[model samples]
Target: MDAIDPVVGFFGLGLVAGMLRSDLKLSSGLYDTLTIYLLIAIGLKGGFELASRDVTALMLPTIVIVAASAVTPMVAYQVLLRLGRLPHPDAASISAHYGSVSVVTFAVGASYLGRQGLDYDGYMSVFLVFLEFPALTGR
Candidate 1:
């Protein structure tokens, strides 16, 4: 049972469905409901685990996480504006997208690590929540 087997299966199903022109589109309401459910589940799981840990111990890592979140957007904006020669607004918009964390990507990474019998800090979900705000507000 490979960790990525399910991921691959879902991707293949979507591809096959699209190629066959199947009428399998999700309704907007269903899509929104699923998204909300996923987010709530992730947040609750993380929060339940995080609640048992010492806040002081997580402080330094949280600071570093916040700093990285702040710095990444600025670096992205500069690269897009200077190297890509994009307009200011376009560069900023792209940078904001890069700065925010994708919960779906995080979930996939966590699944991969779990399959490999590896562990990450439980506080990472808190970091994801923090990372989302600065990118949007900073711009």
Candidate 2:
């Protein structure tokens, strides 16, 4: 019944399965199907909520999200290159990976917030799409 129970349970199950050398594995097609299902479900849910709201209301937050997405890669790339002493190409690759948002992480966080009875802007799904592009192209 805890907010993070599902997250903890799933993580623990994976850890236990791995440690036990279980043969549990998802087929590639099933994996892709699940991924696509999740993406479309989130997009449709977000879009439905978004449709009820005014675009101008989300503009400022969208701008901030996009700006952060753009800045994160630059900062990561610099840190990796200078502090980590990584080569240019390696640093850039790592930065791109770091800059992109993890959909699974976002889904878990959203679920946690919902379980805790907290309110978050539904437009966040739209923001996720916006955040991905800058990080990918920034490098």
Candidate number achieving the greatest lDDT relative to the actual structure? 2
lDDT of 2: 0.83
| Model 1: lowest-lDDT 10 consecutive positions | 1-10
- In model 2, pairs of residues that clash are none
Q: lDDT of each structure?
A: 0.81, 0.83
- Top TM-score hit: 2
The residue-by-residue lDDT of candidate 1 on 1-139, one tens digit each, is 5445564456568779999999888899998997898688778877977898998998998888888999998999999999999999999999888888888777767666777789887667778888876955762
Which segments of candidate 2 are over 4 A away from where they belong? 1-12, 15-24, 135-139
lDDT of 2 by residue, 4-99 (tens): 466545656877999999988889999799689878977887898899999898899888988888888899999999999999999999988878
- Return the TM-score for candidate 2, rounded to 2 decimals: 0.80
Each candidate's number of clashing pairs is 0, 0
